[model samples]
Target chain A: MAKMTLEELRKLREEKQEALEKRSIEGKDCRIIIGMGTCGIAAGAKETLSTFLSVLDEEKIKHVAITQTGCMGLCYVEPTVEVILPDMPPVIYGKVDADVARKIVKEHILGKRLVTDHMFDRPAADIIKQDGGR
Target chain B: MHIAITDYVLEVVQNAFEANSTETRVVLQETAEAFAVTVTDNGKGMSEEVMKRVLDPFSTEEGKHPHRKVGLGLSFLNQATELAGGELTLRSEVGVGTTVRFTFDPASIDTPPLGDVVSTFMTLLAHPKAGSLVIERKTETDGYALDRKELIGVLGDLEMSGNLHLLKEYIASQEAALS
Candidate 1:
């Protein structure tokens, strides 16, 4: 099979940009970040990240930007992920495998409803504060 | 997640970075008949016992990942490599880090697509722990290599979404030029 072509990439970028514009016009922006720290990767964060990317692409839901970060000091929450919606606090979800990641994309990201069951109880700011602003 | 071979390569790179590697080198070589990828890292390598257990589909270190009961990356890659009539090799040392190399017959019926490597590289560039990354792609006709430092100098910080897009364009253009 051939590698992805430049044209395909251009189209992908265009689609994503259009999605972003559409969201911005509605006055909102969203970002999804997956933790890829050692524990995270060991727990399958790589696959989780891949799952989110593929899900977002398959759904053609472009308003959200997908990114990755190191361990959030939540080792027990290997494969931890954070979702930030427009004007809302960042919600961190733990034990996120492929299925959980898909749900986060479909429900939390596109549907605008938080998945309370899997979310970390404390908000991101509180966690940062406890860590002394690392 | 279902994806192409290149995405799996990116997963391996992520694993290397997670190990706190000071440097990671990825080499992808493609010929008319075969495709090969190798990732080497300079981080804390695994012990022999750990390395032996890493290949088992049922064995993953506890506390490493929250919910996963197994580590399937190597096992899955091994299956794919063998399905393509190729082999997977892993070498490691206690403090020297690890190297994972695999090859596949591109013409094999079971071989998967190469996927979007440009995006994979861009994603790696965005990782904060990615100290140094060198990706080289080669074919019988041409080849090109990208260094992280050079990329940062040419396109600015990859953490920014705008720069990530620019970096992807740059890589895609370069790969196109190679072909």
Candidate 2:
């Protein structure tokens, strides 16, 4: 049996309302996706995602939807992250740790500049070929 | 809600969070005879009637989940512990808070594994709503605790996940040293 008091319900409602307001704002077209599959988890992807969340919160950065996904078949670079900005190509970055994640948010997302060093360089055709080959 | 492993301790932790408690504390202990866990939260506690039905897998207050009929967290935990020759206890005061304690016979064949505790703590600590979490694990010889407040003071609010790799290593070393 599970039970919640009226007060608890009210608290939950407030939390949900705050979350909705945080998410449903206008002009929030930037999306950050962190790979959290088994390989990614083993490689510390969760920590990378956490770094992004804290940094965004500390900076009061809004309108960015943060989420997690499964493996991208790039096991060599386990902690992969994809950033999609409105009207820009989706950028995938590999080997993203806490420090690198901060740079992604600061330089790429906010500064409107890509961090070229950590960018995933494999061509789409090559990735497709590898997948099809598998 | 759908846990692949039967360790049910994670659900207890989640419930403490759902209680909208201002503070939450978790303690895990392992001894020669049994393994024990207790979660305490400074949230709105349940009524006597409600607490009595807490294990009634189907018993839940109205307006919790509009889509689901049963509230199974506590109920399932009760069943799991009992099957493992264990006991689950809850103590609460309406305006104060709630505390749940569960113990399992370590030697029992039906006992469930503790599961991936580092992941559990990481997930819980990552939630923005989780104001503060105190997790302490102990065996006979030694124990270590991670307090969010102390961590923030030391690490400058780097985010739980940001520091999780180091945290995992610290926990592993502490456990290893617990001989």
Candidate 3:
């Protein structure tokens, strides 16, 4: 390889910046909230959250916000997650492991469907039906 | 409820983030005789009254949880440390930050296992409220330090899930290189 020139180095830097700087939370309409409370972490929430992050990256999914918060008060079914889309009421899922976390990224976020089995309480279907999330 | 030493570290450092600290530092040091960690944060500290009974499981910050009346993280950790012939020291001031240091014999049966520190650190990074996290790890013969801000400047965004796997791998590799 030849010695890199200044112009070439600048171009490369900008390219890398543009690619890596794709993270923008503003105007994001989708959210993946994971429970990171003591209970949640003890139950392997870290692994689940990691799976979600990697899957989202692999899928190149945008307009989504992934965050972790303290206890959600559902310690019995820890590693809980809440998925909130623009037109749907928040859906809480419990006992989410790595597999379910991947399914969430694909089946729920990409396929636009619900992972019903892992859902905390049947998807709040009644609330969605009442107003279609308004 | 903590199965690993990392669990306790995670549970305690989270308070610093929740307090809206702009910066937090965690130091983990270990040797054959003992293991210790110190977490210092430039966040809102508690008053003397709160500090007096901070270990009381039944007491919690006011209005933190409507239905819950207990904060078990510190209380449980204090109990475990005490049983393991360890000590948990907490120093805080209203305007100043808080520094919490705990130490225990690494060989004690009551001491929890040292779980995946990398995973715990990554979990801390994943927190939305985690501002600038600095981690310094030191063993008897090895040492390393990581700064979230520096990594972000190099890797673009930590929240970008795409970069997390790579970051995790990098951190894991760095730790593996240590003694």
Candidate 4:
């Protein structure tokens, strides 16, 4: 992980300010997730999330913000993560280590291609209702 | 009630570990009318300001940046307790320690049926190297306490990996007896 001084942390926070605000907005379509359950943390979701945040910082992807959530109910395959794109299907990926997290950023977030193997497909009925209709 | 309490206990224990606690104690007491659960940790404690915001569901501590963005664990626990006609209390002093207590009215509509507490306890014990978690469960007539150090001695040299299934079964039976 890259160590950021107070100034750098503030700068990074400033640079991502818009993205963060956008995420907080009620109707925006963004990919957001984190599994911080005991099982997930023990499985290393912390490092995985940090990797994603760093990648987002490095890539400077706007309009998409990452956030943390609790357990997704699957303890066996932990460090579980989910990605939601606008008007599209939400994909949940499990066993996400740092390497997998980087892949998710590069391929899913940037290339706009869902990584099939790691993708967790939810039944349509269970899809979380986003702020907007999307 | 069961799921909420279970989730709250799990989250609180995790926080204890995150605060660099070496030893933690959890106690659950059940009566005909209510259930009381307490978790105490000898970790790097927090200040009054941090304690005030700890249950806000939004404040993030410095070391917790990587693990959380919207701090919801304690908040969620509080909500769960409230919905169950229970109360959640937290006490902490910097450089001293922290303790969280949950008191629940057992018959409330929001209370969940107590589920597999033993499994949660087992998982904590399985990771003894990270820290020691002691769980005590009490009812009017009897009580049970599990200490990881004791289990380690029982297993002796034989890897828990190999005997995990057997251990799990033993624990299940013990839980059934308690229930």
Q: Name every residue pair that clashes in candidate 2.
A: A1-B54, A1-B56
Question: Which CAPRI tier for candidate 2?
Answer: incorrect
Per-residue CA lDDT of candidate 3, range B52-147, in tens? 888999999988768898999999999989988889999998878899999888888898888998899888876778889998999999887778
- lDDT by residue for model 4 over B1-179, one digit each (tens)? 22646666777887888888888998989998889889999999999999988888778796677876788888877887798898999899998889999888899988766666766776666754436677888897867677656555454321333334334554565566664
After superposing candidate 3, which stretches have Cα over 4 Å from the reference?
A1-134
DockQ of 1: 0.04
Total clashing pairs for each candidate: 1, 2, 0, 3
lDDT per residue for candidate 4 within A69-123, as digits (tens), equals: 7889877888999887775567788889999999988888778898788876563
Candidates in order, interface RMSD in Å:
7.2, 16.8, 9.6, 23.5
Clash count (model 1, backbone only): 1
Best by TM-score: 3
lDDT value, candidate 2, whole model: 0.74
**Residue lDDT tens for model 2, B43-87:** 889999989988888777677778777888888777777888889
Candidate 4 residue runs with Cα over 4 Å from true position: A1-134, B128-130, B157-159
Off by over 4 Å in 2: A1-134, B1-6, B158-161
Candidate 3 vs candidate 4, DockQ winner? 3
Cα lDDT, model 1, residue B34: 78
Candidate 3, residue B42: lDDT: 92
On lDDT, the stronger of 1 and 4 is: 1
The global Cα lDDT (0 to 1) of model 3 is 0.81
| Candidate 4 chain B worst ten-residue window by lDDT | B156-165
In order, the B-chain TM-scores come to 0.94, 0.88, 0.97, 0.89
For model 4, name the residue pairs that clash. Answer: B1-B111, B1-B112, B2-B112
Docking quality (DockQ) for each candidate:
0.04, 0.05, 0.06, 0.01
